[model samples]
Target: MSPPKETNNKINTAKSSDGTIVKAGPIVKREKVILHIDGDAFFVGVEIAKNPKLRGLPVVTGEERGIVSALSYEAKALGITRGMPIFRVKREFPKVKILPGDYHSYVEYSTKMFDIVRRYVDDVEEYSIDECFGELTGLDKPLGMSYRQIAERIKKEVNEELDLSVSIGLAPTKVLAKVASNWVKPNGLTVIESALAVDFLQKVPIKKIWGIGPRTAELLNRKDIMTAKDFYDKDIAWIKLILSKPYETIWQELHGISVMEIDSAPKTVYSSVQKTRSFHPSTNDKTFLWSQLSKHIEDSCRKARHFNLVPRKFSIFLKTKDFEFVTALILLPSPSNSPEILLPLAHAHFENIHKKGVLYRTTGVTLLDLMADFVPQDDLFGSNAQASKFETIHKQIDLLEEKFGKIVIYLGSTKNAIDHKAQDGGTDSEDLDKNLLFL
Candidate 1:
């Protein structure tokens, strides 16, 4: 853009801590040190990080059910994406090395990179395993350098440690930084002046901004609003009519708004949550449903833990091949560590939703009525005389798992999926929380 911003007049010189001269790009006027790093072809990058041999070769990972979880740039250049069928990926990129998703590897890289980032910024938000946002507030210590200085260091650090490249985008607002980061991708930094954000976005297509997907772009296109600038200073009612959903946020982002209003406060309400499984279809045995639920419970709790929130009640819901749906939420005395205690609770709900002889193709478990963990609630006493002892054992199990590892514990009833994975030790999915991987 603008002849890549001329810098031929300035002589650049530096050592890369390796006694090597660093060739520099043009001098850019960077305003805010809001750094965004997005790992290029992330899951594939992880595969290469773990086994360098996987580099250069096209690699695709997912399940035998034929879903593409992640693709190397080589595969992507051939037109593959997250949910494309694996069979087509194979047919298209025949040279590609197809493997089941190594989610664990992705998790490790995600954790390690952030551990490094936390050293520099106080507010580092992990948006996903492959992307993150960092904010630089004080001009106090490394206080003197331009915003570009911080972004360059971050880019170099991540590349060196992760053996992968990440594009950095810098600006005043999160939205602008996010857009700038995407400007020059696959290992580059692009910074837009805070003042010029509106003008800059006008030159870029509407689809370039986040949240505006294909469907949104098509709608905007029909209205002759093809770029971010097209939406700027436009009638609010027109945008509301056009967007239909998330209109306000879309308008603000287009105007260079930094704070993510919805995420800024981070709602704690556990309105409802659902997890689904795409099975092999061969193993539709009614019993296999428990494995899916165990995974769902584990994942839901992890999300609950992340928000520092917990649920006082749980609900189990299911869908069948016939298109029927059913759900139930069992109230618990106190918030539990996970829904492992809710196996029976889920079972009770299922009994109500279960339709006999209905060949169910898909199923889900939902948890709702969430409350902050601090809120007190009563226990669900059992019918047996040893009910008190049962409750104590359950609490003890949670403590042990919390102190040691989740594998250091087990629940007899829901042990099917949980135990199998733990006993096998580490698979690619092991990198994610057991529940998340399973879900």
Candidate 2:
């Protein structure tokens, strides 16, 4: 049986004990100006930055994963897309150039881009490797430039110093800023004032709203809410009742009300840390499979330590050639981030899930239930001393790696995975350090 649609009967007015009608306080509106800066094909842009000759040519990255991770606008003009198999691209688009991903260079460029933004605006949110949101409210008079002029200056500086193209959007809120940034492609600048937001939102489909997924878009379509303006036109109480809090926040932003604040703080705590690697040519050799899993554990633990965190539980998984996952979760006796402590437990569980002659293509480990490693807590069995000793050793190892590069001193178990050459003649795996630590 179909259930009845939930209804909201709440109103803005209320009755006091004295039977007097009372109305809610007047709505307070705040003025906010946000800018979203997005890179145009960031990974490919970095490659072109290194060698200007690659510009105006069809180029792609992700040679390591045998898939198209990022492609230039020129390549996109030929109908190539992200996640398309490299083999297919070579066969169909013979002239398209494919390059291995230089994640280190990408991270360097990303840092420089955000740093440049911070020089203009102190409140900057590093949204991703290629995207960021900056607050520019009330800075017009002090900075001696309008919001649009500030955005243009930022874009110009980034282009001149980094030799990369960026699209920028200036709007009243982050959601609106994102929409404006994406309005034009490659290198574009768009501004959406609060007064004219409806005009801009009228042309935006519900699916185009940030954080709205396909399923939500389908549901909204069934309700005859087709565009951003349609969604914004709904009653606030009705939206709160029908959708989740996040969507309600988006609805508020669509109306040019600054409901979401810009988070400019650095991320230090995490609930979980995960590291995974997918290699070419599925292998059935038990030793090699264990080596891959070991590397994942080492990488995850390294990140946990960098954040001064330790995990009390973890899970290991292996992906078969047919794309099936076999996983095992293990709870530790105590929270720890030492590879010496995790390797033994992971290997024992790996044996239980490792099927004979079953080829596997990926291996991963996830550290869960993390907490600050301020003080070592000893279990009833009293293993704190041993754990402390390993902690000290890892601190030194981390120092060496920081000075040199990652994996300066890895566990012997990861030797096989580290030494093995890439069968596809690409990178062995993505550098976890560069991919994870962006601060």
Note the Cα lDDT for every prediction shown: 0.65, 0.85
Over 278-387, each residue of candidate 2 has an lDDT whose tens digit, in order, gives 87788899999898888889889999999999999999999999999999999998789998889999999999999998989999999999999867865535787788
Q: Provide C-alpha RMSD values for all models, in order.
A: 7.4, 11.2
Model 1: CA > 4 A from native: 1-33, 63-66, 137-141, 214-219, 240-245, 261-275, 282-284, 298-309, 320-341, 374-391, 402-412, 415-439
Lowest-lDDT window of 10 residues in candidate 2? 20-29
Report the Cα lDDT for residue 297, model 2: 92
Number of residue pairs clashing in candidate 1, backbone atoms closer than 3 angstroms, sequence gap of 3 or more or interchain: 5
lDDT of 1 by residue, 87-107 (tens): 787777778788877777788
Candidate 1 lDDT:
0.65
